[model samples]
Target: MADPPPAPWIGSVAPESVLWPGVRGTQQAAEWHNAPIDFWFLPKYAHLPHPVVPDENIGGMLTQLSATLRQRLDAVPPTPPPRRTRPGERQDNSRLKTYRTRLRPNTQQMEALRKTAGIVRWTYNRAVEYLKAHPNASFHDVREHSVTEDGLPLMNLSWVTPVLYSIREQAFFDAHTALRNGLADVRAGEIPNFELKFRKKRALFSSFRIRTRDWDGGCLKIPNFSLGPGQHQTKIQTGIDVPSLEHDGACIKQENGSWFLLWQKDMGEEKMRVPAARGPEMCAIDPGVRTFATIYDPLRGTAAKFGDGDHKRLFRLDTHLDELISGSTQASAKKKCYRMRRAANRLRARIRHLVDELHWKLRSYLKQSFDTVLLPKFNAHQMSRRGQRRIGRKTVRAMMTWAHGRFRSRLNEAMEVV
Candidate 1:
């Protein structure tokens, strides 16, 4: 029977089947992580050979391709650089939220991210130096910064290091490529500045690894990277719509410090078709100090208020703890304050969860009572300013910390017609 189907190729076999001889059974069966490998077509490189094409040929094509891209960008208009805004003048909540997220990264990850940032900065400076020296020549005519390997120009870098072989390398290359293109545009008088100043700030870890087959067409194996020893591995497969230099997935940390690769499959927007309808029904949301949210339903002619007394109590306790922390001289007292602070954070998370549930209930009521919902575009910052004048500044700031914008966004997303 064709030599028993060549001992049932484990890699090719369905994850559900019983483990065959010489095949290792994974900790989990048939997860999204252990799915089959697939390829996506890159629109920009559709006419060119596949990524799996021979290294020498790929290098030659990429060199010519880079030149063509540089020329095209030179013809296009460059975008104007962003202007620096005063600290108080920046009103965008999205920007503020992004700033808040930056505070979440640990020390180690933050350090790594900073190193990459430095690399980018160095690359930009070098590129500028090159451009300045050769003012007469076009950027398209400029050669790449070459590195030597074994006394020869390192054209084929894929074999040298796994990091070089990764999608992260591609992303680094693409970022520099785009910057070069932008510079070219500026040089041609297509737009304003030849340089865009990137602000130094914390950035998320964008690149991660996943297990895949070897470069020499060998059996499937893990790539050379440090994962915790004896850790169960999960492979996640994701789809790509737009061309990307990074894998569309993540390696999630488990309780035992093990990581499972979470592949982001189907990276495309779900086409949402909303049926034609009249204007949304009027629903007044009053966010106040007494209550978290007060819903005035016009359809039912009723007002419902949701309060978080427990959260308020926790907040008060935290305030007392803070006072104790400030006054205390002993180390143990400071430790006690830290514990209280941790408890306060947990309580805050719970309060947020409760708020989300309340919003969900309000949405359900709206769906049943009316065809649509109408809410006043409440500017939390403006409201906070008003509150500061009326109430105390500390009280207004506390209210702002509750994230009224986030609450409003959640409501909009839940109630929006799609």
Candidate 2:
């Protein structure tokens, strides 16, 4: 069939600027100029049918939306976007995508969320303490007796509305799970120093994961918070107290100043029946220390290589922390501890960002560009051993510290598309 002609734009604005769903001030939608209005929702919206409900019911509503709305939406341009990879950018075949958006919160709403986090941290700690005291406590017993009348008085805490919020249930499970795992680890001789960890108020991130059922488009409907009116495209019937979320899969991160919600929507080949044969064959994937990875196909005479990250700053930070700890008095020990933790956090963040980026890019590039990725499994523990005195200290440390397990998992996720 012959397709409709492309929609006309007024000046720099899109044809249906006011009504277009994919055009917005978001990370993903910022590239709307690259795709036609008809192809606007192609990547994310490909799963959905034409109508949310019956056509007749929505027909009257559609008529109300300007007369040229359907024409504007349906018309397609000749060329499609993302034809080839950019010089440096990596692509993946993974269907899961996360959408993040800022939240507009007043003072009260922010505090309410913080309180929820505090209660969760407290609950987790209390569970650990109970398990420690009673060595023979079963998982069921720990779950039951973790939050009780005689202990932490979690039931008496009037502020914690456990019934209204679904995160409360997850928090309860997290506490129970932590104790169970800690005990099991102790039994396995994992924690040699009798070091069952405890959760502290300063240590927890002030964000809670929502159940999939509770999450609607852009907004999370928790018990206390409400998704108020005067917002954009809020089809969900929620109050002002609810917080608007972006995507699912990603967690709700409470930053230094305010809360930012990161969400992800998983895309699948089974659901979409997307063909992998559209791309070339990739024979081997080598996760290298020199570069991040090396992909080669002898038959095609083509190769793809990913670069490694420089973690010198992390080692420098660790050295600084060690220096601060050694030759220090008891009075300055607490200060040194704080310094060490802060440095460790920065190091962790750096590693996490680099590794995650590498994983995402490599996985995506392989998925879109290759039909199949053949990977030979290597034992990370064996490869990551500390070198003998023959090697330099830096080289030995590098071997000891590389996170090969995480790298493997990322490769696995990216290749699981088919």
Candidate 3:
């Protein structure tokens, strides 16, 4: 069949200026531009057949929408995305594998790590302010303004010492990367352009990168900090044998008051093996607020639903967080602030773990049952923002917590998804 001519300003239009036709509110109609084939209800005026229900039965827009939805539900799934690489190409010996081992740093070593991280936060904030004034300035400009030729510190960093030179240097590099990446995202229309904010110590204090030269056997040497017997060094708690690494490592402090080291090391190549053949079955997944996923198999004439089953616990945690965060205007003790922060962090960690477990289980089920999984483009933001048909605040909260993007990632890992 002869295809219709493409639109004139399709490729050239800026994302913000483009007007989408059928998607009532969101600019997500642009999502269809990347697809090669057409689908149901797109553009709202495609020459598609109507549902079996008579026109007389449809009274309002809601009824018409329900009829259209039924038609869409019965339609065949669209084509799957093209695979990026062959099965075994992802984990070749040439690639580096990252290991996150817990660190058992003593009180002195822990203090030193915290101090270094604080300095990094300070340095990065300074760099952000510098970029605000001189938009074209690079990391070298900040470095020059912050320190002297002989490496003596300048720029309000009275706590800076000669031993912490490496930490300072790495901080500048990180700050530069952050600014560059943020600007790139702005240009790409993924994020709106705005004034950069300082990195707050209260926020998830990002990890500080250190060179991997300190890794010796199962011990990591801490710079600047002194150990009683020798220079500061900490043992990594892991059963696996530590391999020689050639990159930088990051020291991260977890929410539960634990420290860990994220190290990347090259694992040797393995023999390429083809993946097992998948069964000839397909299913459609509809993500909803109440259920984690609603599965429909037209071939088998059956349907199923899955739920996280952690609703009660999650609700309790949410209520606790709300109580802790309320009444921020009044003066509160440091003890109260500490308790609130601890509760919030623990809740965040628990939610993250639960979501991971849920997705993992869904992936296992999809891999076992279906050769192809069909996932609709679900925009929780758009769903919640519907003007007249907007969901309740509680429902919106539950839907947002589903983390649809993470679920898609899990499906991609083990299943053929459309």
Query: What stretches of model 2 exceed 4 Å from their correct place?
Result: 1-110, 126-156, 162-165, 180-197, 204-209, 212-217, 222-280, 308-336, 387-393, 396-404, 416-418
lDDT of 1: 0.39
Alpha-carbon shift of residue 67 in model 3 (angstroms): 32
Q: What does candidate 3's lDDT look like per residue over 345-411, in tens digits?
A: 6777777777667777668877777755757777777767867435787777777777887788667
Candidate 3 Cα RMSD (Å): 14.5
lDDT of 1 at 247: 28
Cα-based RMSD of the predictions, in order? 25.7, 19.8, 14.5
Instruction: Go through the candidates in order and give each one's C-alpha lDDT.
Output: 0.39, 0.50, 0.57
lDDT of 1 by residue, 1-418 (tens): 2333533333433552232211255332321111132211000101111113236764565456445544543454455465433222333222121100111224443343334334434434444455456544433333344212332235434433333233233323333455666777787898897653432222222233222211112111223332112244222222322122122222222211111223322222232211212333344455665455555443333444454332364356446555644544344664665554455445555555555555555556555655444354556676567524556755665575456677666554444422
lDDT against true structure, model 2 = 0.50
Per residue, candidate 2 scores C-alpha lDDT tens digits across 1-418 of: 4654643423323432432223253223211121122311111111111113325644554354323433443455345354332222234424565555566556666665576667666666666677678766765576566544343355455655442344554554555555555656777897854545776667524665555545555354444444323243232322232344333233556644446666655555565343332222434565545444656543343344454344454356546545544534333566666655565555555555555665665667677777566565555565445562444566545533445567676655554422
Clashes of each: 2, 16, 2
Model 2 RMSD vs true structure: 19.8
Question: What TM-score does candidate 1 get on C-alpha atoms?
Answer: 0.39
Sort the predicted structures by lDDT, highest score first. 3, 2, 1
Worst 10 residues of 1 by lDDT: 41-50
Ranking of all predicted structures according to TM-score, beginning with the best and ending with the worst: 3, 2, 1
